[model samples]
Target: MTRMIDIIVPVYGGYEESLRCLQSVVSNPQQTPYRLLIINDASPDPRIHEDLRQFAARHDHVELLENKENLGFVATVNRGMAFSEDNDVVLLNSDTEVANDWLDRLVAAAGRDERIGTLTPFSNNATICSFPRFCQSSAMPDQWDVASLDALFSRVNVGEVVDLPTGVGFCQYIRRVCLRETGLFDVERFGRGYGEENDFCRRAARLGWRNVLCCDVFVFHEGGVSFSHEQAERIAQSQEVLQQLHPDYHALVEKHIQQDPARLQRTRVLLEMLRTSPRKKVLHLTHHLGGGTKKHIRELSVWLTGGMDALVIRPVEGGGAMLSFGATDSAPGLFFSLPQMYPQLLELLRAAGVSRLHFHHTLGLETCLWGLPHDLQLPFDVTLHDYYFINAHPSQTDTKGRYTPDLDAQSSSYPLTVSLEEWQDNQRQLLQKAQRVIAPSAWAVREFQRYYPGLNYLVAWHPDSEKQMPWPAVENPYRGERPLRVLVLGALSPEKGADILESVAVAAHKESAPLEFHLLGYAYRPLADAVIEHGAYSEADLPRHLQELQPDLVWFTAQWPETYSYTLSEMLLAGLPIVAPDIGAFPERVRHRPLTWIEPWDSSPEQWLRWFREIRDFLAQQNRHARPWQDQPVPRGAEGFYRDSYLSEMESAGEKELPAVDDAWLGSLLLQSRQAEGRQGRLSRKERLLMHLLMLRQGRVGRLVSRLVPVNVQRKLKRKLSRKPIHELHRK
Candidate 1:
């Protein structure tokens, strides 16, 4: 008779996610008898032991093992497996989510052939929510079976068994014979992380045991688990050991990681219903995984409109993207577009099919960039966009609430550029956390060097201007002979200069410049009285409108330091020379072309008309020189503005040393250390978090939040002056 299935969870920190993991595991609807084995690896934070004690007291099937010393990965996995009395021992990563029948499936698969020593499961996507929620991210894909099927959905066979390559990562179902013969996990040889699985699998295979993949068993795994920097270093050191153990496996591991031919993003909608946001979720997860955070500067990426995807990269990976948003106390009228449609964007990025992500931005990022723990786990470099140093007492103003576009002053206390003590307090964590930093501009490079001294950073420039030009140059589709119809595109808000455009339209009508102007965009008012009120036209409507109105010039006027104008880029691509405010990155992106800049002094309609007329006449004279900005010789380096200039130099790059720990209400530590750590050693990430709470260090801000808000609240609430998160966007 098959005695029992012994399960092991060796963790350091990760308390909450761990709790959820256990709840899922113990409640795993399997008829086969099972027992849970939890090893505490002398975790610095102790609450892990306390939670285990509480859990063990309640569950008869659970057993607890404590390591008095902080036994690294090698000893931990082996120690956990040793505590198992069952014939079949399942080595499971604490961060993994297992399906209900995951156990039976793996056991059956591994038990199929006497030579089958171990069984593995094909993986599923995992997510990390954006900052702040880095403390508590509940986002994940659904593992439940489909109650109904859709024609567009990928046919999932659910429980059908399948084979695996060499190793069974995360979920490894090992046989008793293999363990007895080869010993559990090449303890000394494999050490921890990466190649250990392959090493073990190879060994099992060599021992005449077959390693099968139980494709039917779906498992969810986070990138890394909660741990301190020291533990992480120790984990990295294991890589050398892995290469030494089996030199041949080195190529295989490198091939698997680097040769990820298809762009598999962290976020992708698993089912037809939702998408994940990788950036946001990955940020949140950095805390859970043995990783950290970094400061980031915002860039007015012209041409690539942020829309909503920038807000969340997880939905595109794990679940489907979000669509509509409800009005919130913070940002009213802030429409959340395309979150649910992120799969399309992810598909494009993947289609780029580059092995690693290579992108750039001009400015430095904010102090509180990616909200995650400081133990940065990823071993790769991503362009940081920027880094800065703080000097004197600084005041910042950006992102200060502009949900209504024209309502507030055109700047925010956007901290992405500061290197002040306060900024460092927010950024040091990410700085200490990111694997490598890439600064696109020399200014950004200086800032990064000033703050994160000796850190591995590259002062790289964005690929030359030509690469940035949009594709498929089209002739003026709106061929006009009569009224030289003009199009004013963008949100019909105050800063968008909609009112100004209204005056321009009236002025044009009065002058009878043989021109008719139609405002095209999403209607924002109670009702759109004109052709378009929101003033923002969809891509599909653009061609139709062009064919119908045959507009001559597309004017994009934003009375703000708006960078990289997407509208301008589109106009340039459409062979339509545009009239846009020459500020921020706009001048840099669409340069050496006939355009009009809105000067502050020229507020009168006549003055605007004169300039508009000159612009139109220039367009008429240019003989369809409407090719992309590629052929246009825009003077380089002329486009320069500190994205964080609003922030005093004192605050641009961190000034003072790293900030003192947040004194705000570290009233208690969650686990109180005693129960937090186990006999074997440290607790998991969840345990450490609980321990911090128990120690009164953080997590209970009673008066801070009074209500539960949905994810959709951000966009709708940004316009509410009273709502701080969104209220920063106050109307002028």
Candidate 2:
């Protein structure tokens, strides 16, 4: 039996996109018999009407339909469906372009299983059916045309499909049998667009039919070209109708998002694309601890321009590693269990055609990962963010969190499963394989070479993404009339001088000195009552919080030698008068600035107070106390240099053409992580409510509701419902 499909494209606006869509439809070759049914639903554009007539005259397979008046999208699509005679129907948008055998693949997928009612193809902008990232719009990869992408999908994703709660309508194919049973789209409820296809899919699903994503086909959807102006309003209205008819619609979609059954298929196609492309991809291996190291990788990924892409493999819970393209919500991380799946991980990396390896830190990673460069035979680089290479503890601090200069004594007292020498040997072996050893500061280079001599290192200053602006001159209320206000930034772990901050706060309070202290970040434990903790803050919001506080002096009490500090860079941008210990990068970073003061690293809390008092007295004597702060120049533009440093001409381990290995285990592990059923069960009552609120906020109606609600009230509700942020809840 010959299968036929009627491709119904409802054209209303967007002249150029409509022309291209029809041209592509007519030009593309299809294995199955199909007719192009172009509908001009009372379009205001006369050029489109003439073009449609020309298309109908030029091609016998093409048929044209016209609406005497503006009947909207639901009526237009129903008219086309009514014109079809017992044939499967495809509701393609006017802004979509088709490629080689796209219709053939959709028809093939529909015929594969008898119960499959509707199917949507992979697209660049088709919501749940979108590629590169599901449920998000993705741009076409550089240097690739629509035909090339479609061909790649056809080749790589042959016979691949995933179940979808609802079929996306950008290029949806509906079976003739299923269409008859579910009936045409609800014209009365959804006269224009948006929720019509979802309603049809839901109705079909209730009648024991399945909606699927046809992964092998790729279409280009230039979305929102038709009815772009009224999109938000129409979408909001459509959501209300959907909720009323199918109360479980949101839940079904949310469940699909949680499970993410299409992840493996998407990953496979993406890896294949990257593998074949000429673009250079560098894999960065880092720890789970979110700090400067993670921040560095993220910035580097964003900064690297031209022929370069950065992927990350970071340690996760359960001793596994998650390979992620970038630090973004759309870019999902693929998990692979460590030690047990080390071989699989290696094969996966090679298959992706990773050009080089970059190790940022190894705190929580498996010891076996130390030999990755050697095992994979790939040139690599190692950036020394801390002293993990020299000591088991990255900070190299004593019990009191003070810098322990005596290496021999510290090494002797170090607690480890292996001897200090053995541990250092392992690190030495890893460093030896690196094509380049990177240090962010000159101080870091000097300190690192003290332990690992004769190793060449590259000094690249970390780039600051935050652009600086001059701060308005505000008279420090406490400068001359009251106690001088001091501020400390960042999370103060023991090695970061938490104890010192506590002691200084207590000393200032006990003596009733003309000084006050505030911490923008939390300490390791609760500090003295005198120290005011402002809790934690994100880097993006740091400047706003700092401006609000208007501290007379910014203080850093780090007890260890810092390699490079991102927070220090932020402070530099703020251009506030600074006080820090004379150790690590602080002295070099803050050198030659008149308003900056450096205290001895080993200075006692009382001595630190005296230094603060001296600064207070000096400011009091100054002719002008309040002046507009200017941004201090910081080193930037290392993106190109870093890109060159990481990129290599040497062939990757994958270039040797290793035999294919079954990646089923990796897929299974990834699926297990995404489908962790206990996630919802562990949520508290408040968290459950917060989760539902998050769902509502993410839905179409959410945007409308946000506009209706007062901004401050919405914020308060968010704060109360989300005591713990949504991201943290997801992690749990």
Candidate 3:
């Protein structure tokens, strides 16, 4: 048969404190099969007995023990212990609160050794087991939450147990074998309170039983609540009685404390370990674990695992999964309503001791930055991948693929259903709520500042840029080349200057220029016959390809202001000459590198040909001698930069309180943006009318209209008709 444990709380006065103790026990019940016995020691207040009776009536495991007359605390606890004949007993004061898993941890530690007689856990004011100091009164720090502290204790001391000369009685657990061997507390000598537990522990220790302190558990004690007025007198009398019973008690305790001055040091070390554990729990909320953003997040997550416990929370097919690094478990339907989700999320965060949250992208996910509750008090930051927050079209380009300088203007070319004003408002709300904002380049920071000024931001390069590349100083890579090979990397879309590549390839082939163009990305359009296509390559495959193909020059032909170019950084690291457009971060990245040429954004095809010719000439001239690449100090890698930024934020998070964000205004803006994105790709009334008219004139009428109208005149009419009011187009 499994032996049950009994927890005996000896109540004196202070009905409110006693009630709180009982309520804490009831709320967080022990996992082990245990019974609670509340002994009312004939308190002056009648309400204390009444409350205990009502509580015991409601709980089957709880029993009320009423004394006909007032019997002090020691006798009351002794009487309650007699009721548990074959079970282990726990002496708990009525003015203390128990945390979850408190009993299980303590009992488990005691059961580890058969000779373990008494076990006690650390408490706020327990004499020997008091945290940070022995026999000193202290309270839990305000910065430490109950749940976080409980988690910290579990993490810091997994199986640590220490031997002590005496056990504090505020909350002590005594083994059944120890009680049977050493007998109960000496209530006759120490009648009132205070030194009974110490006397009992000393007796047990003499009988070859160990009194251990379970450092992994913490219980809150409201010290002296029951005996506040008479504690001094009671303590003095108990000491006198204890000295008479055991003459060498005080000397033995003093010798034990003096022998290990590190006892206090050990306690402090353990507490500090719990307080500053390197295992910072972080939850990364993103869309999917793929693409450039996902790759960046994965690198950052791996780096964080050096001193943190990182987890990724992303939406799966149907629901989502709270996955550790490289774990496979699809938790379906984890997110629901806000009220239902907050508690579940909070519980998970508390259990994991998550202190920081990072949001990357939330395109497909229902819950976004605006949905997060502010009361959680978790410090969070957002990474801006693109201008998605400022505009529905992330590129902020017009219909003809040109950058739009004015943020407030409505574009007729790429008409997203959302207005510029609404987009700006939503962006403002998100930026204001975030504790920090991270961008990849200075251009992105400047762009964001244009909308929301005076906001502090962090510029973190891609983590891949931090890799070390040995300079090819000894060997000239362009030796005996039949023609200077030029490589264009990245997706070959129009935004990446696919047209420019085609024009350059055709122009070079027609003019018989001494340059060979090789394309190493997804070819979106049919390339010119002269250009060689290598198809698409993964990030890992790119280095091998670059080594094998040893292109003399690389072109960064991006049309958009490239936020940050990973390809350009890689080429520069390899000491290869590069020809890139003078836009975005290209000029800033390739600043001091020799054999580099930059073309204007609006440069013509002939101008690109001219730059290529100049680069080829420069490479030929350098091939005469072994041109040692110009050595410059390497920039700080992404891992170090991100780690420093993260640690700085974490260290400062506790010192200052984040200003409260206006959730109502933010929520409205988010709702409006969501509604706009949902309605995207739907045709407007003018588009529908034009489609109908074109379909109606597909036969003889279309032919006659086409013949009668001049081409330029017809194009002017269509352009004028397409530019209509945005609000009117959205009307039902």
Q: TM-score for each prediction?
A: 0.38, 0.72, 0.49
Report every candidate's CA lDDT.
0.45, 0.78, 0.67
**Alpha-carbon runs more than 4 Å astray in model 2:** 1-116, 123-130, 133-148, 169-171, 175-177, 186-196, 219-261, 325-330, 407-414, 463-485, 502-516, 550-552, 616-640, 648-730
* lDDT (10s digit) by residue, model 1, range 490-579: 555444565566667677776677566677673222222323343455666877766665667676755544423445655665666456
Ranking by TM-score: 2, 3, 1
Weakest 10 consecutive residues of candidate 2 by summed lDDT: 465-474
> For every model in order, what is the number of clashing pairs?
146, 0, 0
lDDT (C-alpha) at residue 204 in model 2: 100
The sequence of per-residue lDDT tens digits that candidate 2 reaches over residues 522-583 is 87555677998899998789878987887877888899988878887777667677778887
lDDT of 3 by residue, 370-489 (tens): 455364567788887766666655556554445565633454243445677876686677677778788877778888787788665777766655444333432335653578898998
lDDT of 2 at 479: 44
Evaluate residue 32 in candidate 3 and report its C-alpha lDDT on the 0 to 100 scale.
84
Candidate 1 vs 3: which has more TM-score: 3
